[model samples]
Target: MEMTGKCRLLGIVAALATATPVVAADAADVYGAPPIESGWKYQVALDGWFTALDGSIGLRGLPAADVNVSALDAIEHLEGAFAASFQATGDSWLLYSDFMWSKISADADVGPFGGTVGFEQEQVLFTALVGYEVPVNIQNMQLYATGGLRYQHYSVDLSIDPVFFPGINRSGSQSWVDPIVGMALHYDINDRWFVDVMADVGGFGIASDITLQGTATVGYNWTDTISSSFGYRALYTDHSDGGFRYDATQHGLFTRLSFHF
Candidate 1:
């Protein structure tokens, strides 16, 4: 499971229309609240992750087959990266979404003539999830199961500039969607402290070979309407289509600030 770049991006969503309070006024109230309502609760989260990517990619019509890349070293050529997410919660239900983007380019000397070979890659990932809470016996802990859809897009321009292979230029784009199923756990440690953990698995020949993700977060309530959190997330995906191939694991530390209404 992985989400990566030099710094990983996290997402947050606005509150949903529901019939419950977003946060407790104090420690005792954290465990219980009034019956559900029709109002909405939303959260916007901003995150940063020191993530590294490990994967293999290839393009058809190229002399070289698959090129291995490590986000650790490839990051040195990164031009930019960012992440963001949003969430909406209601009594017994929730909606969430996030986005991540990155741009990178690399250059290498090739051929006896000293010509150059290089490529520019841009990757984007977006995900949306919906879940329902199931009543459990554990006090102070909320448990839920979720279903989600994810779409990933990539564009690459590979070339051997000036000489290696005169008139050598190739560009391509691919996008796919995956359906995922998973669960989440939310526990109140006190009025101001809470913990959240989530895990998901998907892809059965419909999209990528297979994909999985997991997250753990510790959060502090700054106020009834605002909070901040720190966590870790990891993701893994395996895909091979036509002459394109990508198998990567991205993981690292993550931090976020959330706003609830």
Candidate 2:
């Protein structure tokens, strides 16, 4: 476990950089809500997630280690990041897609070894879903049942250089896909305001043992084709393969600006 300390330090970087929020079809519901609109409507959004990471992670068969990093702490190590979402709704059906990517790296002292260890990681997350809107009895409210696939890819590189021992370098990558099912609810409070809530669960051991996500947002319509939302989101994932493991929960405040057509 000579590299455990370095792993823990860099794990914080990985967790924070990977904290992109999950996106849903109802992200812009205030602007394009249902009574089952007949024509096709489309929306594109840019999202920001300020999240904290808490949980354990293991790399290359190393024992699981703890990581708890605040959003502010993660910002220092994040190299690059991006997140975006798109949705199209027709008479009772909707198609939604989201993509997120991040890269992070860190350097730490290797105990008393008089050397430095560096770690870097890059991750990508993507989701696609098709859903059918079901009119509910509640006035000004709509519900949608959705099913989808989530894809994840990760690449990591670790290097250790010590004064007394030979240098060590390791690099590896993994990818997996999971099937998810969920529901979304949108309620219009008035002509200009609305609320949305969504939840989903998946994995079933097909890839990760389990994965869960939830979000709640309050939205405002700026115009017929523009809207904004602010909310809270939480996501959890657990996966292990070939000695690499990632089990963590990411949660925080999120905001989005969306355009509709």
Candidate 3:
């Protein structure tokens, strides 16, 4: 794929940028972290989410149809997929990015047509963010506020297939980029464990009517450059135009293994 090269380049840059103090196992006691060293820091994280999605989609001459299912169910019918994340940091600044893509085929019963329906769904999402760590008086805690851009693209191909009538195929796509702002809070309970909470809001008429995302995680510092985390994440968006509408919520347990450098 043409995007393969771009993905690789992004990964490399993230690896270079993500090496910072958040993942360090040993640091001074200000917050169980040392002041950011004067070079590039990077991290690569692999995450898995047992995702469930709920939404509605529509085509020309047809009313919007609801879509709700587990990502595992969609993957059972998937054609291809890819997902990953990268981060780079400085003493007080950070850069992060992530990408996800999936293609699935599913069955939908169309109420208006009074027949069984089939559809293919393809989705791609990418987010790039830059954050600055804020000085906090609270002990053993770090706060960061960030701003970024999120790109989302979704497409659906519908087939009204049955023995009774001629088959009809309809396809439509929607893509948008929205500016987002959010905050992250991290607190170290001890040397080996920490907690993180984050939330973001976006899509102020830029694409969707509104969009929101939130996450909470507990992390275990395993080594000087490795950490593990488990979290719950949720994302919601409402988007509509004349012919295409995509309103959905995706939430699930998310786990990650991260490497720092």
Candidate 4:
């Protein structure tokens, strides 16, 4: 009787040990690791750089004025931006909203006509976009293509001081909304270092008018929760009408720091 009781107890213990792993596996299959959900991401960026402007002006018949201005002397500028985004890891999608403010000013002298042409340009852009991460791998590098819609507001003020006409001044302003598309390439050196390059193009009016922008950035993932990046960007704008047509090339360095939760 004593032997029978000991055998019964051992058999029950072994059965329980076997069943425990099955139960754990069933639980994992039913409710896997917690799903990554909606969260807030924040970023702050600063940019400083110079631009070059080239174009021509035709005043109906007034000798078809040619504008050959070097933006290098007038391209010193500063900019800042902030953004809030929500990420869904399972779908590899992110919804982001951003606001940016920038100021660019330069002093220029226009010859033969009269006085000095001083230029001041300011712009504010607000955008809401949805992006999907396309998975591509090359060694330790990853690439993604992102496209979205945006609303942009741009303004420019041009002041001209004439040597002949002592107090004559002229200025102009413009604003518009447009759509944009972009792609990014990233290389991971480790869990804590990466670099990225991106570009975008957009059109603003019924005449198929448009603008293009591009950026290249290098970043340091300081910690699992924080990272910072620095890069250079270029922007180009074109218009159909002669009065509103001008080409601007901006080359500047920018820095951004982000916190993830």
What's each prediction's TM-score? Answer: 0.73, 0.76, 0.77, 0.66
For residues 1-261, write the lDDT of model 1, one tens digit per residue: 365542333322223223123343343376665644687689887766556665655667754333445556566888888888898878788798888888877777766778776777788988899989989998889888999998888887777676635657777777898899998888999999999888888887899889998889999998998888898988888876787666767777777888887
lDDT of 2 by residue, 1-261 (tens): 869989998999887666632223444464674544468889999987776677766677445655565677556888888989998887788788888887877666766648976767688989898889987889988789999999988786767788888877767788999999998787999999999787889999999999998889999999999999999988899988987888888788878899999
Superposed Cα deviation of residue 97, candidate 1 (Å): 1.0
Q: Which number leads on TM-score?
A: 3
Give the worst 10-residue stretch by lDDT in candidate 3. Answer: 21-30
Model 3 residue pairs with clashes: 17-41, 17-88, 17-89, 18-41, 18-42, 18-43, 18-87, 18-88, 19-41, 19-42
Rank the models by TM-score, top first: 3, 2, 1, 4
Better of 3 and 4 by TM-score: 3
* Candidate 4: C-alpha lDDT: 0.58
Sequence-dependent TM-score of model 1: 0.73
Candidate 4 TM-score, true structure as reference:
0.66
Cα lDDT tens digits, model 3, 91-190, are 8887888888878888866656477778788989888888899999989887889899889998888777755687787899988988899987889999
What's model 1's overall lDDT?
0.77
Q: Could you tell which candidate, 1 or 3, scores higher by TM-score?
A: 3
lDDT of 1 at 181: 90
Model 2 spans with C-alpha error above 4 angstroms: 1-37, 106-119, 158-170
True-vs-predicted CA distance for residue 140, candidate 4, Å: 5.0
